[model samples]
Target chain A: MKKKILCVCLISVIYSLVFSACTKDVDFNQINDFEVSPVVESSLIFLNEPANKFYNNGVELTTFQDSVAIKIFKDKFIKDHLVKAELVFETSNSIDRGFNLRVDFLTDTNTLQHTFNFSVPASPTNSVLIYNYTEVFEGNELLSLLATEKLLFTLNLQPGEAINESTLGSIQLKSKGIFYLNIDNTL
Target chain B: MKKYLGFILYLACVIGFSQNKQILYGFSEIPQSLLQNPGGKVDNNWYFGIPLFSHIHANAGASGVSTYDLFADDGVDFNSKLESIVYDLKPNDFFTINQQHEIFSGGFAYGPSYNKNEYISFGLYQELDAIVYFPKDYAVLVYEGNQNNINRPFSLDHLNGVAELISVLHVGYNKKVNERFTFGVRGKIYSSIINLRSLNNNGTFITKPGDNNVYDHIFDLDLSLETSGLVNLTEKTDFEPNDLTKQILLGGNLGLGVDLGFTHQIDKQWYLDGSLLDIGFIRHSKNIESYELKGDYIFEGINPFFPEVGSGQTADEYWTEIEEEFEDLFTIDTVKTKYTTLRPIKLNASINYAFGEKLDKECDCTSEDSEYLNRVGLQLYAIKRPRLPQVALTAYYYRRLFNGLNIKATYTLDSYSFSNIGLGMSAQLGGLNFYIMADNFLEYNNIYDAQSVSLQLGFNYIFN
Candidate 1:
């Protein structure tokens, strides 16, 4: 019985020793100091196509503005050509709804001595364009925040006019962008 | 008697070191102050948290080995400190300490949609985790010397199997229970595995002239002491018993969980965001009879290692009684006590600020109502440290062009125990958003490392 007890005691001692070594002492100060660095700066540019809609009144005020679509209606006084032109236009979706006129071709060359007749579309009615006489088309269309009105009536010549294609080579309309909008009146 | 009592006391202390908290997805460890926040419109909430499922994360089953040395590495000082705290024991006893633990931990959360009066939102969320540990070793002692000069050193080694897994999921909803708070939750699933073996060294025996104990046992060739005319001997052998307590068994487990989040906008520029994650349970779906294994083991001359061998002669009659007892101790009829319970939950919170012109208006001077609703500019989000209740800072910058291409850079500091860092990216187009992030870019480090690399992926959606 004594021998048996001694063997058991020996086993117990070994077990106890294992437990003793398991303990560890920790000192918070000695660990290496670590800091999170800032994220590397990278640049990216994304463009969002504007929602499809037209300006308040589709036409622009100035001829210098690009969206002007002018069509010449048939006049009995002129032969082989439609001389009396009634401007039928449509503007982009924008609140400004205006256009400008720069009569360059009219002064540079003359095809016939004909009187020019122009009339504004009815307000809040069937008018496809709105001309804002006050706002002007600034330089660098990409940088300028052109009011939607300028994009509406800025057209210069008829689509099939031979000189219209060459003289007015390009028609461009641009508007400033808007992203996330949270408007709280109380705040 | 006193020593035995003291040993019991030590065991009690070790088991009580930390209250084991099971881990599941979507549970938050964040304090009550942040969790109770009411979500609102125009709020993008963020948070920081830590894993509490140390047991499941360190489980020995998945790794196929015990992590007996994980915390016992050379650099740590827990050894010295632990010695001062435990009861006294001899050197041989130290050999048996199973320095391994089981672990199963994960984290997750999603926010309410960003619109007031209108409760429709496409929130953000994710979850991932793993566990590993070492196996335990058991040894038996033998006697050779008569009443004196008896000595033994630990000589046993073993390997334990281990396993780990992680998953993330979320959905959309509209409806705020209150004007200041919007409550939301997410669902997740996880899985894991474990296998192990115990080895003994003094199994062979040889006849050598000895002064006492005239009888020769199977391991007599194994010298207990050279001076005493005894030779130390060992033979290549393997053991796989069928006893519930001693058997080398493997098991697979799975569970379900949820994540909850709340946000409070303290006036656009400043906001409080808190989230709770991983609340769930694991059930052992399989039975114990499912554990089927097959292996080969070779034994030297006369298998005297097991009692009831040929009576007083050479290897002739095989012993069946001893082997039966072994199986009884190692195998279990049912796996009723095998599956673990609930997993640990974590809490997260963050405060963010935006740079540049703050668009808080309904209409601009140009009669433009939508101009104030752009997602351009830079924002900085600061998070608290991990492990300890401290704070860490992170930054994110966003810019967009006329085209649909959007670019951004974001940095985050992980938990406080070690050095941890992470980065994230996201692109948004016509209601389709995609995101990716790499955490712990420096290199992977467990929670024990003061610095490490961790990664996460994200996605978002918007409805018209």
Candidate 2:
């Protein structure tokens, strides 16, 4: 009888030991502090205009402008996550003419919310002419940029000697946005 | 969202686990062992499992990560830990769960009294199996961004997974051919309620230098996702409560499979036994929905085509054209495509040696019979997976404490850990029989650190 009781007790003890499980200290609330920052790079705009385009029949054209829909900036998710942004412009001129460029961020109703301007120097002696500009938006500027739904770019010819269709050089432009975004999803 | 989370948890509890029942294999004293090796020697003439109380099994395992690694309250920054883990876990890392419960089971010995060496067993069970492999490159791309990794191609092929909830009804035949060998074959009919698979996918997203722009983004995608009977799982879908039950019973997406096993007595003292299980496939033909996106496209950021000078697309025109092209390139086509899936087959083989005084299991006290009270053996187990086969080796010691009680202890080495220890017990109190087994017992003290764990229990009645 004693042996039977001992065996039964041993079996019970073994079963209890095997089934009992303990969890260590774990803080699931830490997810509130989880954050990720990803830097996505993409090409934005490219243009190469010959000097003849600067000629409207016989007179030299002074300014040309165009606009594109900025679909991402107005997104609610993007607006909530975007903390800062930077736009980079790289321009080169083989022609004897320099150009001034103005970028305007507009709302759906064509209301101008933000704007920046930069100038490219002319290569009079046919030397390499390059202009690099970076515009950073933060604090109130970032808010203005996030409210934007459209972007209008205007190019004006700087004061320089310019000819008509016989000119043999071109003005090139390459621009991209380097948006520095800090995203928080913990809430 | 809360309702969806609750439904997912309910499904997991009712369906998932590790399908490998190592300790229960070859433990012939327990009637459930016959399910593992149908050709196993039978100690009783008849048996019946206690309805819903019979055979409950559940297991959750991961190859490279543990709960403590991510959630331990060790005063470390969560983002820092996540970043490190993202870099540490490889594409081969995976998480898997398998679960099964027997609804009913029974077996009976039949034949003329002159030679009663034939037996038949049948049962119905519900099983849930799920596996997901880590997509390491995708994680890195999302976490750290593409600005620094200029040349690396993020592979979408790393994303592979499958989950299924199925009910299986099976009947087995065991025959004792002569005195040296006993072999058995079981045929199964499977009915699946829910299934989702995104396996064997391929694609890559890369960012590189370009002649026209600062960077060119390229997407080479050939991805497809297939699902069956999951349409009503979301809260957005209105479904009757009994619809799920009807689908489980009458959902004609059925399959067939077979299990083969045998035991060979190499002169009593030494023995050999093995089993091959789940060699079958299921044809998903009803209520099937699948999406495929197969295309290769590159983006150089809307080229203005200035080569034609002023005779080129304006900025707005270029943007709109790019948008239209993207819409055409990434159009995901949803189709009612039928497909077939092979079950993850399992192989279990063991070589055992027995010694010590015989435990007269038949109670005949015949001097000619030799059934040892002690046994020591080595078992090899493997299960096919999407990426590779999971394999394990186990060494065990078994002993019969009394005529009605038995104990088995095992040490296993697998991808999880080398120190996995398991224990099982089967006790017969008169006509009522009960058994319980568990693996990774060493981790019971602190389960958060364990990569894998399993438990099984059952109850039955035997008539000898």
The root-mean-square deviation over C-alpha atoms between each candidate and the true structure, in angstroms, is: 43.9, 6.9
TM-score for candidate 2, please give it: 0.92
Candidate 2 lDDT over residue span B1-464, tens digit each: 99998954543322212577889998987888888888887777889999977899988998778888888899999898988889988887889898999989999988888878999999988889999988898888878778777768999899899999998889999998978899999998888888899996898989887676677788899898998877657532667768766665645479999999999999778989999999998999877888888888877764333323235768677677777778777899889888999999988899999888664547746357656888999988878888877777788999887778998999887777777899999999999999999988888888988989888999999888
Per-residue lDDT of B43-92 in model 1, one digit per residue for the tens?
22322112221211111111111122233355745433333222222211
> What is model 1's DockQ versus the real complex?
0.01
Residues A62-146, candidate 2: write the lDDT tens digits: 8878887878885777787777678877788888877888889999899999999988887787666888899998999998898
Rate residue B339 of model 1 by lDDT: 41
